[model samples]
Target chain A: MTDATPTFERSPDLPPPASTVGVVGWLRQNLFSTWYNTLLTILALWIVWEAVPPVISWAFLTADWAGTSRDDCTSGGACWVFIKEWFGQFIYGRYPIEERWRINFGSIILIVCAATLFFPRFPYKLWVSLFLIFVYPIVAFFLFSGDAFGLEWVETPLWGGLFLTLVIAIVGCVFALPIGIVLALGRRSDMPAVRAVCVAFIELWRGVPLITVLFMASVMFPLFVPEGLTFDKLLRALIGIMLFQAAYLAEVIRGGLQAIPRGQYEGAQALGLSYWKMMILIILPQALKLVIPGIVNSFIALLKDTTLVLIIGLFDFLGMIQAAGTNPDWLGFAVEGYVFAAFVFWVLCFGISRYSLHLERKLHTGH
Target chain B: MAVSSEVGTPPARASFWNDPRIRAIIFQILILGGIILFGIYIVNNTLVNMESRGISSGFDFMGRTAGFDIGMTLIPYDEASSYGRAFFVSLLNTLLVSAIGIFFATILGFIVGIARLSNNWLVSKLAEVYIEIIRNIPLLLQIFFWYFAVLRALPSPRQSFELADTFFLNLRGLFVPKPIFEAGFSAILISFLIGLVAVVFIARWAKRRREATGQQFHTVYVSIGILVGLPFLAGLVTGFPLSWDYPALKGFNFQGGMTLIPELVALTIALSVYTASFIAEVVRSGIQAVSHGQTEAAGSLGLRPGPTLRLVIIPQALRVIIPPLTNQYLNLTKNSSLAAAIAYPDLVLVFAGTALMQTGQAVEIIAITMAVYLTISLVISAIMNWYNKKMALVER
Candidate 1:
């Protein structure tokens, strides 16, 4: 005694929920749904208003973007003129005037190679990156140091500014990674004696602050060397930074190594590969891949730590600024100098972190 | 008693070339020998070079007078103080800044972390900007910015910016009214301490009651009342024995009040702001790691939002939060060494910088300084491990 048949027509689609359909609805739900949320929204807007406009006006509207000296900076705003006047020094440091072209060429090669390496669609990416990793440093060293290419010699002491910072960061990472891998392996080795030595070395470096290490290198390293052999302060700082960073990198690498399944090791052994060959060919590739984000993070940290070299009398990028800030010629522009330095560091670090995040997402193996 | 009585033939002796155990021993011995010989060679060279330079190395300089004046000291110190006292004073200063930094940073970090998770679009975005900007810049630069660019821009002590007429800010530093304890003040202190203990007991009792009888108690209000009322009552009985020592301009600088030097202020602010960004990320991740299913389950069980967070979420989230939080604290402690950059007279500045420079005992001074940091790290990690275990989940 039910109805003979049901209606075949579809029910009309209702409008989407009112709280999520439009911009106003979105605003209502997201910003002003509750009284407390509304208050927070207003406070946030006020902060933005109070902060952004002043910064814009100070940095752009009243900024002195022209002229060469401080006289051009009459406006009550940022003195971009001062930055421009010392821009050359900021980039080339105390490198000889005739030899600035070598630094420029070196930087140009670096930028081009880096751009090509990171370019997603670039051909021969592997070979290019390999070249960058292995050969470019040697070539760049000759270009910067000279005396081998019929170019004038530029001492390490003469290196400064962004060039020196990049040098330290790149060289430090390159040298540290292999040492870190070795130490990480040693820490995980079966032999107790090797493990103990590795543990002591890593901990000894990790326990102290980087500054004391630099101090030791500067003040005590000279005493450790034989007579008639002296280390450049820059060399000394590099060594100190390398040892310090290797400890941190070893820990990160160790974490990656630990993530590898014991089955992987067993498989490699079953293939009859020797221990070193197995690690080199099988274990490390996957472990390093897993820890790319961590490695990038440590590299960023090392890049920032290079500024500590200023304490060792090494005139790196930041050291140049600290020195130039005190210069009688550029008095009262410490704020500008520091702001520039901060901006440079922020950009580099932020870029590296963003890349790391991207790599992390891309390399999600779901293990 | 159940051991097998069957005897088996021994395996053939393995050759040394193919033996893993023998190879390991040989490898270890080689490493040990190399390390020792290299260590001796370096030591010999260092000693010879140091002697040639006429710079003797030992920790005996610790007892000698420091002669240098520290910018800030927690304990009494002067030019006449021994190097040991100076070291202690600087260590205390370091701990003081680190403690203050950690306290404020945790509070700010939690607020920012929660704000980041706020449904309010503007609030979360603003929090994001704060974290990104603060975290990207180096800590040393941030310290310099606060010290030279912001705090140094303040008016001189003679024209100090007064806050509530009790706190003053100037180029010299921040000056706040010192709390002066007078006769019978110990009574109020004792009452406060008693109130704290009572609150703990009340909390435990209330929790037990809630579990046993499905009843709720307003322990928060009760505890606050007890804490405040007991202190007030004790102070009244003790004739209100607290006074404020106001700072006054006697000459060029302020006199007769507690002064926090600009260096300390800058260092603390920089450390707090820099470290708070990191802590904020940790806190946000910790809270986020407590899955939404847990909250849903709590809600289905008739738990309100506050109880769901307090009783359900926080306990689990804290397990995730504490390990990283401890790391940030240790990092802040270590980063305090950057105080040497601004001449804040921290342990590094006092012991490693000045003490070493004066005595020319690089090896000894740096060793002690490094040992102190290592010890601090070890002790902190030990405490953190204990706390983590206490907070860890109990599973079969």
Candidate 2:
């Protein structure tokens, strides 16, 4: 209780010791913290040293970039000239040179439509999305096929390379979304028969490989239809892709549906909303938003799986590369072709995943 | 009297269309009717079309001769083999590649997963880069790259890459010295199995003793010693009855060794590497899902880091990891079908590709191929479910 006046002045804080304060400190704490860690650090450094420089020198420093033929690639390094020589074939695979602009125009419109969705201030966001989802596909199809718009008629066989890959992936996803939603709803329906049918359909597709599905579509589909009722090869493959993708998308949407709180359903029901109205107006918007990342991931998967169309004899981007690699003139350029394809695929997949992550972050609202 | 009257009065009945129960039944009936009609239409059209094309359909074709050659097969096969036998051979090939891929992928995945969570920044970043780059590339592209670009670039057999005079790798394939087991080799195998049984028993005994006496035993070290020593002793007693058929360079190519076809090596490597990236992500998320408080609590209980991880963290993490790990395994199995693209003689290629082409029995062959894959998927998932149920938390 005594108010004593005996006091001591406090010393100002000193900087942390050198071993715990800077780059060396970080290295000490993170890399060389223990015997095993130090060993691991050395091993990692060894791996990097063994791998990085050779790759860099081969890929960049010694690569032949500005050449027009196989003979122009005499550097004993990567011959990017091969990729350059076949760039047209790789991008538009035997697509008539004059008619390539249609694909370009369609892609530009798609990009614009996609871009509008990202703009928060856009007034016609919903309309733009609907057009991209519904109307743009038919327009793009007509533009590419050229039978309806007075443009030059390019047969489906000529649809190859990245253009065909984009078409299959975009159309597959755009069509699969509605089908998947319906399937998801059916699976969760109160009606026993509807649920059973949906379950059977989903499992039938999910349990088998896509290769088999494509085989069925290509070989068996002809028999399934009446005689002389020929479908385009590309159309058959697209149908196969859509059915396969819808099953996976249905599962993902079901996950979203399950995640939605039961109270939301009760509230909608309490407000005298019919099941369809409740779903369209209240339940679906929230559920779909919650699973945007999942949807994008599935889209990325569909894009990758589009390569399987090559087995059915449709030359997608990978297929084009495979065909070009086996060309007699470009015999030994498989390495370059594959590397380029890998780079393109990596960029696209990485970009989509990053966008998904961004959307997930933006849409995340705490309950 | 008023309450009784209210309870006794029946509610007003809505129209049949407005009744939810009647509507559900009607909706379901409509869907069922549509499906049935569609099925009948398809079957009728298929019958007529097949008759017109002269394509007979049934499983009877499975008994006919396959009349084709497969590059790599586990069982003895030739052109005279029945289509059924060819199916099995290709199925075994598919299973072989899948098993090897799963084995390697699991090991690589666990390593990368642990590395991603490493304290070393460089290691984690390196692991991250590996996962990102490998995950994005298509598996088929990777297979083609490996087979056509890398393996095909290897020197011819005359100038093959040799490893310690036992392994030879060239453009044709990878050649490893095949083991020649002598008559007494079964003794060593028997001893190994016996040692495994003994270790299990010893483990149980040690656990019981520890519970009763409050004492610990080094069961792991003891089990390892018995497992290795018993096998070694048996081998020594049997005069080490084993020999190696080294892959020596013959006139035109290497001989006297097991040659793994380039197609298989390529497909296996691609499938494993791609699947490993996904498994690594699953493993990382699983370990992350194990709360930090668990680690701290273990530390407070006087357990070291390694034991804390093995005894506490991994068990819980595995509960999260197993389901997704099963999914990746199923994915690897399904993706193995891509082997057809490279003409690897897998089931899809042998049965669905060649057999269907020869017999023109597309419906039967494709259905069988799909059924095989579906069966495999179901079996794996069933096993996974059993494991999950066994590992599920026990609540009082």
Candidate 3:
């Protein structure tokens, strides 16, 4: 009966209090909000202070970069001259100077092909990828190990450094993928015998370390082959790496296979598609899409594992550095050599991982 | 009518080539046959090759003397030790390094993992950088860096980097005080064992009491107190029968104290640091997997942050964390083979490298090495499967 006409008017929201906004507020909230946080902040700062400057001085500020020999380094810091001088060997190993152009050209083709495949807007992605997967390896093999086209033959032993590292990683992953897919399929097949064989193969390779596998390839493998039919050291190492990586890849693919819903299988069966047709046309595409991150991760692991070939005496990037560091002329430059190798590897791996993360984000369809 | 008749009766038999079951059988037979033939070929070739190369194949070489000196060993090993003994020595060294690596990696991993999720910006960034840098670089490179660049750069024993005059760091290796347990040390050890049993009982009793009455007990504090206090009391009563064999500078090298060879140090550091990166990622993902709603639920129930974490969050997180954490452990164990690169005299180095070289028994030696690793992998995977089943969510 007596409704009051008076009402309160809402005012525009006031800006947050000064103490709870901007830079100071941010610092207080993130770094010194609690007693322990403040203590940790101080500790972290002290650690950074203690560690960062000396490294900077040693690696950059006082380091000798523009130099030709050990004598040219006089700043009492890292002799980066060692890395600069041996850069060629670190990259191409003992690859002949004239033949280095083949490596560069092949790698350029690889980069272009890879770019086309990864580029979302590019047309003919499938064809480019097929070329990369099938044709490029043959071309690269002949190009690098030239016994044709009137080019001088560069034996596998002469293949070392980053060039050899990439060769092993690329070849290993490319070959392992098909074998891994087959093994993964066999592992999931209805036939128990097929499953058993696949399981044994995968487990046998997965169980042992790559070093032991390479050792077997080097020493024991010759015994396994026919007499007088010797294999190249690098070829043996490559085969060992491929088989070992395939097992790991198979496991990853199996995970992807398992993640596929049973409904997908039922749907395929309802369509009266044969098993091979169903898997090839329907299941694999979806499953592989779901596990691109896993595949890329396995590839990254394979790349890092390529370093194990060095243990068998094939001079990969790290091996070349190890060799160079021991050179009488470059004595005491191990630090610089290692730093350079670490940086190169870090760049490659970190770049690939970042790309994988990007792809993961891009492909994250709602479940 | 025809369709109905077909449905009512069994369908006509498909041709043998088109029969799924028949196809499957044929395929499996083909595969099995191929594998068998391949095996036979390999064996025949191996026999011929071995004969031609004069490389005898057998386990007889295991009994022969290993005429190489292991730079580091857990047991008595010299040029005269049998290859079998050398294998055991190397195996022990592998286990020793792996144990130490796992312990340090777990600790560092957890800390970094927690820090990665910390509210502090700089701390999280630092953790991220550490994980990224450590993981991206190949472990072998890191080992080389530590062994050749850093450790080898240290001054000689004459100019050792001394810590409290008991620990010495030089080009030779790390020389630390070795604990020498005397006569009455057994009393302290017995007390520790007793304390461990007491803690288990106390923990069980506290849990039962908490269930019976809605009250919490200070189980952790009490258990820790007992565990530490019992040993200290025993030591005090027994006059602390322990001594440290302090390293002293001898003519040109360190003497007395136990020496950790540079190889071991480098291997351990490289392994722990490298593996800690992966473990950190596993832990971060695990903790993140436990939904935030659980925290709020615990808060609503009057639980504090610490108890919420220990009782509510971590238990769930562990179900996700344990499988991957154990995988990392297995990876670390396998990776310890990299010690061969640095001449650490690990299994692959001593048995697979040196023994195989000396005996020319590549097949036997490599086979044995592979089998050992396979056994390890199988055992670990078995443990992982058990743990996975146990920790799996038990839903109605």
Candidate 4:
């Protein structure tokens, strides 16, 4: 051995142990390896230092956490005071200032209904949800627009801000899912006529920008209808958003439909299952599970797209910020208002994204 | 088994639409009739309405002189210019914003995507924060923030910040040196083109040699050398035919260097930042989609990390990346239309909002605007699809 009879000191095929290999090793290799990496580290740190403190200061630190008026905001930070004062309007819109409890109750019902649908342990869940879904719109209508029950009528125009956005998005999602499923199936049908019609319908809506559709609904929709017929601008915009969103939702569902094996489709046919029977009994349940993440993604997009209504003269959260910031007294508060609005948007979208991830994990099919 | 019974037909029936396809033909006839009737009704109503209003319509109005001052234009445009020219100017602005946005977004997105995959805790978390914060917010809101809140707060023009004695920055815009080419410039350009072709040929030859002889040629180094050398050589031969025209200080605003408005800058930056978060996700997924086995196999063959990434990983990962990357590019382009909200003179604002109102040609204006977007989307999709098919998985 000492004479060195070609003793092979073969290189190991892999890296060393955890101490020399994984995360710690990666840090040494990536972050502090060279003059350039060290320089990058310092520059990145400087960027954080420059951007974060001011954001934190404006968002929370030295910010007025509680106040009812702009006058009460003595600190040189965000006037969350304005948000606090207008919080009622933001959530319930212009539902008469005195009758805000009606909206509060309606929201409570919505929350309880949502909790029941999401909670697997809840008893008679589907029946309860079905019952609640059917009842709530009527209940909410009477509670919010109360002319029928000797309460004051709250016009749809009075609905604005977060309340309108949430109602529109949630309602749109609820309506679009079923329509999307139908359209997806139509798109996949063997009949060329049916497929062509579905394709044209979906593509035509998808091709035009959402803002134009909203404009068309707001301005041109009335002309399209018969004389003496009137439509609420808010309702029209909501419909426009729903129709546009449904097309995208159909594509997402189609992806899920395609994922089911042909063997399963053949098996369903062998079992003599009718088209509707095979679909509802087997295919749809499985496909919806597969594409829950896609649906949620579309939902997030629709939620963001709802802000386009701001351009059409509706006061969503963003529009509210824009309108409120332009006030005489709060003339220079555009930055603060926009920042607050952005945070609200970021939180809602981020929350949905996190849920989508959790749902994906829970429903993992192991691609 | 019960197919015949469900169809309420005799056993061994071959056709679903068996009865001379009467149901199908009837349905088709109804559809065609309804469509034709609807078209006629719309046409008749529009004609009657136009005549009643005593307004003429057509492309004739497009050639009519547009009498409005546009704040920005890429080419020489005046108030007396045709509406068609105004439309083109607006389209140019939109293209400028979209092109610049796509370029920066791709760069930032890839960096952030790689950052997210890093083992370093700070970097991954920072990337997560960036994506969540930037992507969730409405793009329209960000544009407004840049236009009204950020850029609007800059100091006045009189206190403009000067840079390198050839550029100026103010609330109005950032002005940089604009080149006024002399006669020799075209000669240099020709030399540059020749150099580019030579480098490509050299690269191909070097690659063939490397494959045949198993010897490294450093194609990248050679190409860079030729590219730089030829350009410099041409410049010298042409008597160094380039000079910068400094943006001289004037009474109110800086004069001369190509002036870029705050609106354009704001729109570009906001679109890039907003779109990057999404592109980052696409890039991250594309990288992750490439199985780790490929990289490990490359490393085992004695390839260094850089070469492993460049030669083994990127080519494969890009096959996955290009599809979604194209999507983000399309989204960014479409989202650039929102610049109109901030008065960025994008096609949407100038053509759809302003020109429509001026001409009262809602149908025509909207159609043209929609056609432009549709054309862009289709062309991009077609090119991307072709590339995607070429890169698609082959079982063999």
Root mean square deviation (Cα) for candidate 2: 2.1
lDDT (tens digit, per residue) of candidate 3 on B1-396: 678875796777898899888998998899999999999999999999888878887788789888889888888888998999998998898889989999999999999999999999889999999999999999999999889888988998899999889888999999999999999999999999999999999999999999999688998899899999999999999999999899998899888999999999999999999999999999999999999999999999999999899999999999999999988998999999999999998999988988888888888888989998888888988998998899899999
The whole-model C-alpha lDDT of candidate 3 against the native structure comes to: 0.91
Greater-lDDT candidate between 1 and 2: 2
TM-score head-to-head 1 vs 4, winner: 1
Worst 10 residues of 3 chain A by lDDT: A1-10
- Fnat for each predicted structure, in order: 0.77, 0.84, 0.91, 0.33
Each candidate's interface RMSD, rounded to one decimal? 1.1, 0.8, 0.8, 2.6
**Candidate numbers sorted by lDDT from highest down:** 2, 3, 1, 4
Q: What's the ranking of the predictions by DockQ, best on top?
A: 3, 2, 1, 4
Q: How many times do residue backbones clash in model 2?
A: 0
Residue pairs in collision within model 1? none
Docking class of 2: high
TM-score of 4: 0.90
After the best TM-score superposition of candidate 4, give how far the Cα of residue B298 lies from its true spot, in angstroms.
Answer: 0.8
In candidate 3, residue A353 scores what lDDT? 95
lDDT per residue (tens digit) for residues A36-84 in model 3 = 9999899999989999999999998999888788999999888888888
Q: Candidate 2 regions off by >4 Å?
A: A1-7, B1-8, B208-214
In model 4, state the lDDT of residue A256: 93
Chain A only TM-scores, each candidate in turn: 0.93, 0.97, 0.96, 0.88
Q: Would you estimate the TM-scores of all the predictions?
A: 0.94, 0.97, 0.96, 0.90
What TM-score does candidate 2 get on C-alpha atoms? 0.97
lDDT of each: 0.90, 0.92, 0.91, 0.82
Model 1 achieves a DockQ score of 0.76
Candidate 4 - CAPRI tier? acceptable
